[model samples]
Each structure stands twice: as structure tokens, then as C-alpha cells.
Target: MDIEIFPYRVLGSDTTEALLNDLESLEDVKRTVIHGPRFPKGEATLPPKYRERRVININGEDVVLQVKTARIFLEITMESTIDEIEEICKEHIPYGFDINQDRSNYIRKQQTVTDRIKYGDKELPDELVGMTDQYSTFDDHVKIIKKDD
Candidate 1:
């Protein structure tokens, strides 16, 4: 149901952006979550090449990348999708990576009290659930990227 991709080293913004773009394009990928320490405030003080790219273009939408990619959790439908994901990773994460089908709750798959209180009776789309940062308001975190129909 879910697979975790761990790179040998934390990935930079360009690699993360390329990997995410490829993964999001796959039909079997339902959702993807990036887990790691976020770029600290005043990160711009670092050299341009070492700086965390705050924004990246994915499927034509600009998204702010909050974290340095330590791990990537993906919800996939078919087993074959794992191999496809590996291929995409090979191209982007050239440093090598490991994929595990761990049954851990990497991402919240169900709605919570916060969801009902925040959304009221209107059904929240499956794609939108668990995409927000608990530390920040929904509007501050999620940049709704409209995928092609």
C-alpha cells in the first residue's frame, strides 16, 4: 500500500524537485510525502549552490519545498509502480537509494477531529488530507497544485 524511499544522503532541492515531478506524473502514485528537517530560517545566508530552493515547479504548479529530503513516502496502487519509482529515482538520486514496504504510519491516511472542525460538513478530498503542516495554518502550508484532469 505504501513504500518509503530513503536516499543515501539527504537530497538537495534540485534532486528533490526532479524526483517529485517524476513520481507525481505516475498514474499509480496516489500521494507523496517528504519527511525531514526543514530549511532553517536565514538559510539564504548559505552559498547559492548550497541554498535550499524555497520554490519548485511540479506539474506546472509552483510549490514551496519545506524540507531537505530525508525520506519520501508514496501511496501506490500496483506492485509494478515500485520498479517504476526506482527507475525515476535512479535518474535523479544518482547517489543510490533504498525502498522499503514498511507498514509504518508515515503519513496520516484517515481524517481527524481537526479535519471535521476545520472543514465542517463538506467532504475533504482524499488528495488534500494530511498535506498540511500541523505547526502552521493550512493556508500557510499547502499550496494547492492543480493536476491535469
Candidate 2:
């Protein structure tokens, strides 16, 4: 099952870091991807802190966060796990957030025509599967994280 987390406000680097770290710690969480508009590139006058791509720690691994978090999509094993996710969100996203469960297509469930064309006979890792769309580049949107021991 998958759940879409929509925050009331666009999250800054610090909040994104904290939220991702917390989410990655859950045992039932299979995979997570943050999707949103890309940060603007040519803002030389702005402070260095405002520039895009901040490093965030997820399950003790440091990942370069390229996009400001507009929505977080999580693939969890059980529906009951949603409560735990909501509890974490309530703490991090104090403003508010909606946990949408209505959409069954939030995450892709199987291989598509694109996958067959991209890698003809090659097998993909489970974590890398169902991550990208038919028209888009996989690595451009998919950020894979290793689980902490």
C-alpha cells in the first residue's frame, strides 16, 4: 500500500531532513520518494543557504536533497502503518498535512512498456522498480536509500 503526504506549506531543508529521517526509520516502510518542483538555478544574489540541494541524513546515510519537499510518497507494507506515519508527520509538520489514501495509483505496482524498452532482458532491483514514469528518466526522479543495519 502507498500513502501520499501533502504538507500545508512547502518544507524547508531542516524540516525535510528531520521528516525524512524519521520516516526512513519505520520498519514497515518499503520505499519513499519526495516529489516537487525543482529549485531555481540562477539566484546568485540570494544567500548560500537558499540555494538548491541540501544534504539530508536518512537512516544515517547522507543524501543530497535536490528538491524542496512538496509531497512525500511512501510505500508501506501494511495499512496499519499509516497511523505511525501520521504520528511522525504530526510532529514534524505542525502546520498541517493530509494523508491521502483514496488514490490506489500513487505508486506504480508493476513493470510498464518503458521498463521493457529501457532494459530489454535485465532484471531490476526491487527498490528500483516502479519508480519512474514511461516518459521520464529514472535516475532523475528516483533516489534510492539503503536501510540502516
Candidate 3:
């Protein structure tokens, strides 16, 4: 399976930078790239051209971190199961952050399978549903799911 993982968060001046610095220190991470508003304004408020890419505030400042958005991409050649993928994600993703995957093509194919099963054209098997919840650029509305250590 081929997969891409995007992990992102909003933190308070220098905090985002500090987090990026800390991320760079991690041995598991292969690369880290930082991008913000072309010119800093305040948090979440970006130049119109970059507005669509906005995620949330960066450390009391109105900035979104793109490095956090493009964390890792993997191509699994072995027979690892989906559980293994989920475990890897949980291990690397920071707390109180959001993760998104550009799996539109995968979802579309799953939908076809789902439809076939609904029509009795095929047997119903285990299914996975992908849904995205509304998020704010301020990070005020989102809550993180805690994991057992």
C-alpha cells in the first residue's frame, strides 16, 4: 500500500519554530520543511493567495505550519496490514493535531465496492469509511484524541 500522512497543529511566537526545531531532532523523521504566510501578519490570517492552505494559528500568532502538514509518505512493499499503518501513524503524530490523507482515488474505489454489496451484486465484507470534520484556522474548535502510553 502507498500512503501519505499529514500531521499538523497550532501553537503560540517561536513555539511553532521551536516545535519544528524539535521535530528536526527526531531520528525517525527523514525531512522537515517549514512554510508560513509569505509575510507574517498575525494567526490564521494569511495573504489571500495562501488562504486556502491555512490550518490554524501558530503560537498566539496568526500562522499555519505546512511542515506539519506533510509529515511522511510510505510505500509498503511487504504484506503489512492496515493495523500496522495505523500504529505507525499513532507513533509519529503529535498530540492535539489533525491528520489528513489525499486518498480520494482509494475512497472512490471503496464506494464502488460498497454500492455493489448494497445491491446484492457482491458479498458485503469489512468496509472503511473516511470522513473529515470541520476545522478552524484558530485551533480553538478542535480537540485531540489521547492515546494510551
Task: Go through the candidates in order and give each one's C-alpha lDDT.
Answer: 0.84, 0.83, 0.37
Task: Rank the candidate models, highest lDDT first.
Answer: 1, 2, 3
* Model 2, span 67-138: residue lDDT tens: 789999998879999999999999999999999988876777777777778756688777766665667776
Worst 10 residues of 2 by lDDT: 132-141
TM-score of each: 0.86, 0.87, 0.27
| Candidate 2 global lDDT | 0.83
Q: Name the candidate that leads on TM-score.
A: 2
Q: Summarize candidate 3's per-residue lDDT along 99-127 as a digit string, tens digits.
A: 33455322221435434443345443322
Q: What digit string (tens of lDDT, one per residue) describes model 1 on residues 1-149?
A: 88999999999998889989999999888778888897898888998877895789988888889888899998887999998999999999888999999685566778887777667668888877777545577866666665577
Going through the candidates in the order shown, the clash numbers are: 0, 0, 8
Deviation from native of the Cα of residue 140 in model 1, angstroms: 2.5
- RMSD per prediction, one decimal? 2.1, 2.1, 14.3
| Winner of 2 and 3 under lDDT | 2
Clashes of 3: 8
